[model samples]
Target: MSSKLRIWVTGASEGIGLGLLQHYQNLGWQTVGSSRRTQGPTVADYWIPADLSDSADQISAVNQLMTEVGWPDLVVLNAGVGHWATADESARSDAERVFALNYWAPVEITRLLAQRAEGRGLHVIVISSIAARFGQQKLATYSASKAAVALWAESVNEEWQGSAHRIQLILPGVVSTNIMRHSIGRDGQALGDRAGAHRGWSVERTVRAIERATRSGRFAHILASPGVRLALIMHDLCPSIFYLLLRRKP
Candidate 1:
């Protein structure tokens, strides 16, 4: 048996997931990565191509990981889809797809891994969004899905009290990723060039925060700008004032 630390990261082809994959690889840990695309950036020791949103593909990917690399010491459920339509403009199918990948995928993966852990220790990191904190405009489905996963992790953390298994939730704000361009639009198409521009923490910084949180055994980590943190505080401490501020935003 190998004593090397093993890690599995979904959505590892690009963005934050890719950053995490490289981070673990540089640490000399055994790295396993999965993504919807068959061809990867050749960063991981093992790459399993699967669309995590689909139930069968999710199960198959997990089974393959367990069979090939065995249960990983750490699993990062970072695979998710984003939506960018107003609540009224959102399509039912697109909403379901968002939840399928962003919410249920991580939840199901957690369940499967726990069942396989069989009392062995396991740490799962769920990559939620800072948007999960409140109902923001034009991101109803995306926010809802993230909020669902965030709450689910919280509940599961309580259930695993005093147990060997642990779940960590990571709520990261906008990173320099193609997520906006890739977000689903009102017509169930990629927002593409129409998506609004955003700039925030780099993937390296976000990954560093995640690593710091993991080392400190924090239950939840929020990687966002100071302004975003202040907004969240205001939302929690003064709801009426928070909404008033939001309304005033142009």
Candidate 2:
């Protein structure tokens, strides 16, 4: 058996975060899970509740985890929401709410963990989206927020060049999750039918990739699907072409 590692997974009540929590716990690692609500699985060692949109609550939750678990060997910032709104119909409040949880909250949590885990072999995993690679008509805000997160992870990885601590960005394509089912457009219209087919691997496959990447500790960024990987490369090589292809109506 592999040596158990102390791990913390945010947004652990459901989706990728919950899957990771279960996987690690089954691996004999001590896992701490956090979510805004109390619907998380019962396997985690600690379930800290806090609203990620509130800075104070986020900080308090982290502090509470630190007090009880010291510093986690791995911290996965996997809690996020998806919003699709036309530029004009998207309310300012809606955009801000999305940024709060998807971008700002993760940045704050990672910053605090980086400081607390200094000198330790800490690995921070950020679950960004393939949307960051190219622009989608109605998902402008969501794409931008994820792009910010991916960029932030790259910057932090650069900063930790000579240190033991590392940051990994997991950019996943559309997966089977409640986020897709519950997505709404700027006009408060349901985008469920427009979500398109699931393109790549299952959530389990992505979780396995994360586990392998975490163990290998070689790649700083992980593209969850072949399509997303290709899109990312294309975006880097020929952004115009990538955008043109991604701009098709869903």
Candidate 3:
């Protein structure tokens, strides 16, 4: 068996996933990455190409990892898609597609890993958006899916109280990524430039925060700007006022 520390990162083709994969690689650890696209630039010692949104693919990827690479010291369930649409503009199919990748994929993957761990200690980190903390205007479906997974992680952490396995959640507000350009829109198509530009934390900074959180033994870590943090505090402590402010036309 390989003695080097190992980490598995999903959606390693880009965004925070790619950043984490590279960071660990720089540390001389064994890195395994996966993406839906079989052909793409990636940084990983091993690359498993599987569309995790599909149930069968999810199993196949996990089996491949366990059979070939043994087990990783850390598993980052970061494969996710974004959706942008108003309630009226959202279609059922699009919503399902969003949830398939953003919610069910990670939940199912974590379940399989936990079962296969067989008393082995496993550290699972779930990357959920800060948007999951509360609802948003155009992010109805996306926010709901994220919230579902975040809550699921929270529940799992509690459920695994006495076990060697643990679940950590990363709630990042906004990181510079192509997620916006690739986000699904009302017509179930990439929003492209219509989604508008977003300026937030860089992928490197967000990854550093995640690294800190994983080491901090925290159940959930919120990576957001002070402005965003204040908003979340308001949402939690003063929902009435928070929603009242949200009602204002922007």
Ranked by TM-score, the better of candidates 2 and 3 is 3
Poorly placed runs, candidate 3 (over 4 Å): 40-42, 246-250
Worst 10 residues of 3 by lDDT: 36-45
Ranking by TM-score: 1, 3, 2
TM-score of each: 0.97, 0.88, 0.96
Candidate achieving higher lDDT, 2 or 3: 3
Candidate 1 lDDT over 1-250, as tens digits, reads 4578988999999999999999988888888999998887777888999999999998999899888778899899998878998999998999999999999899998888887887799899999998999888899899999999999999999999899888999999889898998899998999899988868889999988898888876798889878888999999999899999999999
lDDT of 2 by residue, 221-247 (tens): 555556667778898999888777877
lDDT of 1: 0.90
Writing each residue's lDDT as its tens digit, candidate 3 over 52-155 gives 99999999999999999989899999989999899999999999999999999999999899889887998999989888988888999999999999999999
Clashes of each: 0, 1, 0
Residue runs of model 1 more than 4 Å from their true location after superposition: none
Using TM-score as the yardstick, the better of models 1 and 3 is: 1
- Candidate 3 shows a clash count of 0
Query: Could you tell me the C-alpha RMSD of candidate 3 in Å?
Result: 1.4
**What lDDT does model 2 reach?**
0.80
- Candidate number with the higher lDDT (1 or 2): 1
